[model samples]
Target: MMMFSWRRRRATRRMARGGGGGSMTELTIPSHFLCPISLDLMKDPVTMSTGITYDRANIETWIEGGNFSCPFTNQPLHTIDSIPNHNIRKMIQAWCVENRAHGIERIPTPRVPASPVQVREILDKIAAAAGREDCEECKSMVEKIKILVQESERNKKCIIANGTGNVLSSAFEAFSKPERFEKRVEILEEILSTMAMIFPLQEEAIKHLKSEASMQALVWFVRGEDKSRRRSSILVLKEIISSYPEKVSELGEIQGVLEGVMKLIKEPICSSSKKASLFITYHAIASSSNQEGFTKAFLQMGLVSLLLETLIDAERSVCERALGVFDGICETKQGREEAYAHALTMPVIVKKILRVSDLATELSVSIVWKLVKHESREDEDEEDGGVKVEALQVGAFQKLLLLLQVGCSEWTKEKATELLKLLNNLHRERLECIDSLDFKDLKRTF
Candidate 1:
């Protein structure tokens, strides 16, 4: 629509400069260039049953939304068949190339939509190849399926429509069989790869992949030697865990799963894998009934220092997930003690209040709140009281006060105010400098 409006103005200007024929090129796009529905130039032009031409995707979306009438004709459509208009497409491509100097890009030909029959055929091939020792054929079929998935959204819909999800679900179950324990590494990799191809489907398809056997197979892949498989496994697990939080308990039961998760956090893998590991850890620690055992294992795995180091990474996703895991773990007494023992823990947590996103800011405030609350109840323990003093020394007072000064989320504001009050009540004489500097502002707000 914007392009049409611009072309209209340009055409008016061209007509006003009567026969001057200057060096400036005319921007008069053909009237027939636009689609009737969207008013945008058609890329993959298709003729409908009503003899109306529209872009394939736009018309498909219309049909999928239960629109039976033709968009332009206002007539009831007999069928939804959209035959490709090859002549119009070729003309559009030629016109685009001719208008290259005017900043128009040539549209790439749209990939053919995967038919249901073709999808079923490919699924059959994949299923037949899964049982054999030589999985080269299976791998080849998966590669083809991946290409089809990457080609277009229509192909993904077609594959999902043809029950490809069950194929992948079956593959996961087969990979988990005890008899397949001595299988070749290539076969296992291919199975994981096949799942990865369909991993981006809808939730209904993803739900089909949540069996116990599949979960175990994924845990095996997470601890496997192949980096790519490990990466895929972590990503898939992240999606599944987010969708089904109850599965976290089952995932936690697998031996070495937690260790593998911690290993992923410590390794120099991609940020996605690290984020997934952080989420899995967060869910496990947050929902586990045995807080003592979970906290002991987490601290024993050296998550405190690893999380401290991760805070220094500049990626926001990594930072948000790291803080989430950190917040969940710090709820336990052992976790709190471990965090306090880390030299950089307090400083790093305070520094992230405004440096990262608001979510990070809230989590950081919660961590400090929990730490201070823990210390507040332990009046006799000199070591516990020392944490509050250390926090003051590291400028926690100033940071929390500043957090209130700038308008943050209501929760963050409340937490900061509470922490500040705790500090003010504990050491009234020590906070005189900060109070005098911003006393009126703090008094009015609190």
Candidate 2:
């Protein structure tokens, strides 16, 4: 058996050399010189609880990615804490030094890992700097925090766990007044940029910035040219408004806030910015009392055309959100009138019924229902001019039937059925009365 083991290994080696049975030079890297996790020479070697060693950055990344087990052992880790493997690091360094003539580069010493205590100290320094009149110190501290956040996702979690968000919110609240906006624009921008990086902000932190004056400052920030600031501002705003939906009405009262949100919806700068703007718009008109004001502002800003444009090419999620906001606008009499007035409004809405998602389908039906209901009354006053005629001519009724044929929520099916019946009634009335109408004039009007 021993002779067979030796022969088998030798045969494998010979085959690896293209079956030439010739001598081949292959370098074998020392296993001890490499990290167990990365299988690369360790620059900042650290040992885990399972007695296996890995590079520090790789382990931290593993931990941040929600792994709590040793990669090699596959055992549930008692604790993720790791200590520097100084001896192994030194050995790797010496090996690199000895192999310098072979083109290996010396590894630089790794910086000491940040501890919770060190992070706490930095947070205090940032708080102190923010309180001081010197914007330079505050800016410096913000830059340092940004670096720490960029170092590891764990660092971001650490800073957030230690009330960094609250401290930053307080600093922003201090400059919430418009009087200080110009003077503190740079510092405020830095703070906002930092906050944007730490997303899914805790409700507590959002509440700190949800005050009237603080929210006003955020609105002003959203209107800025810096797209990063705008993104951060809108994200924060979306979180806050989502939490306290009742407060959305007051946002419409803020000067330039509605317009700022509308501008984002009109020409989305980024996907995130566009989504944030959609959330803000949806929330603003969510309340019945606020719909009148928002509808007026939206129409004045030409959102009907913008929404139609957005719906045509937006991704499914953005399409759903855009449809939601459009439906909200159409709930009001003014909104319904404006939407019906747009030439492409009903057609675009009809196109989205089953093409997007279930939510989008429902919103489209609701908007059509509103338009149809309003136009039914208008048809009584003027026989030939109504959304029903345009919708029928544009094949909206056929889409409605297709909507019913395909499965949807019970409410959607019921609504579509009702709209179908109304459409059929209108079609029958038109056919019965066709003998009295002029065909040439009908073609011109349509």
Candidate 3:
């Protein structure tokens, strides 16, 4: 019993030393068994009987006991008072000593390579098997090849560049052959899916490929004999807007794509697809100033109402993007009036503005002020033409008053006051419309 106690004390001292009296020590473990908390050897490496080792409880305890966090996950340690498995602890100690002796601070685990040889072999197999003409089998093989190429690319190697480029070029070349366009489309789809995964890892290489192969694929798919292929191309173009915005912008003639996307939005066959296409088109338009023609096309397509509908999309990102487009359109005088006219029929616009809380409220209030000021200027010019003052209704003024009353931030309130002064200057008759509200109540609310 004394000998066992002494061994335990020695183990505790070893652990304390590795922990550096609560500071972290760089102790290396097998890449698979490293404890995230200490970035060192794990204690009582809890392997299931099946050889899967993970000690969630031990990890949590170590983290909590020392106020430590996992380096990868950043999760807080919550508890660490129980004894670990003795055999596993011994194994971990032995392994740590072995690694330390070899000066192995961090052993990188083996990862699957994304290489040209692997891609070339997969392409050769596909080419040889072309006589079978089994679409499902072809798709399966293409998907497997794509996955392998993606995995290799993710391993931080440039092995797939030559192979991938050749494969894509051959696939595009095959598109003009009899019964090969469908096969080419399948190959392009696989390549696109793989590119989506590997692009972040090999961005520069992927960008070049996207500008070349992806562009060719998109053009072919869009102009294909098959309607399904055309639709698929549209979907892929939308994906490019997100993954390769810079490259997509370089393609030029975005108006044609915007028109195509807008037409699809009006079709009931693919409502969600249409919405996604429009969302991407809007982003593409917002990304470039030269594409104001696309923006004008959006306005011509009754996009104001569609955009308003999108503000309440189930996807927060979609809603944010739609709002951003709306804000972008309202930046100019003509666009502001166009937006203001649309806002009059949509009460949700005001409700959405209110829901924006302080930050959004401040911005919306400022936008409203600018719109009202512009309208006032227009109203002044119309008076000389015998336009009746009473006939004109400034819809934004009442909303601004309500916004001022409910606004919570000091900045919002001060801006609101400035807006009211501007409105009085534009439509002096409208001053009584807001003065009826208790100024004291507005101040208290703020």
Candidate order by TM-score, highest to lowest?
2, 1, 3
RMSD in angstroms between candidate 2 and the native structure over all alpha carbons? 8.6
User: Which window of 10 residues has the lowest lDDT sum in candidate 1?
Assistant: 435-444
Residues 1-446, candidate 2: write the lDDT tens digits. 01224445656777888785765443334788777777777888989898888988888888888999988889877988888988988888887788675456889877665568877787777678767655778778778888889876657777878877877777777666677668988887888888888877777777778898778888888777777777788888887887888888887788888888987887677888899899988877777776777778878888888989999889998998999989888878788777877889977887776666779889999888878876646464575657777667666676676666656788888888888877786644443222222222222111
- Checking candidate 2 for backbone clashes, the offending pairs are none
Q: After superposition, how far is residue 157 of candidate 1 from its true place, in Å?
A: 3.1
lDDT of each structure? 0.77, 0.77, 0.50
C-alpha RMSD (angstroms) for model 1: 5.6
Per-residue lDDT tens digits for candidate 3, residues 1-446, read 01224434555786868843443334323565554434444533543322334454445454446645443545543432333344655665566557654453332232434445666666675544443444455456667765665553233234355444344334433332435555555655654455434333233333444554455556565544455555655655655555677654554453255555555554423444554565565565565644566567667777777767655542544444455566666665555656756643234344444454445455555555455555654555664411112212423456566766665577767767776665444545543242333233333254
What TM-score, over all chains together, does every model reach?
0.77, 0.80, 0.49
Name the TM-score of candidate 2.
0.80
Q: Where does candidate 1 stray beyond 4 Å?
A: 1-29, 37-41, 58-80, 93-109, 128-137, 182-184, 200-213, 376-385, 398-417, 428-446
Question: Model 3 clash pairs?
Answer: 61-79, 61-80, 64-77, 113-152, 114-152
Clashes of 1: 0
Instruction: Quote the lDDT for 186 in model 1.
Output: 62
Scored by lDDT, model 2 comes in at 0.77
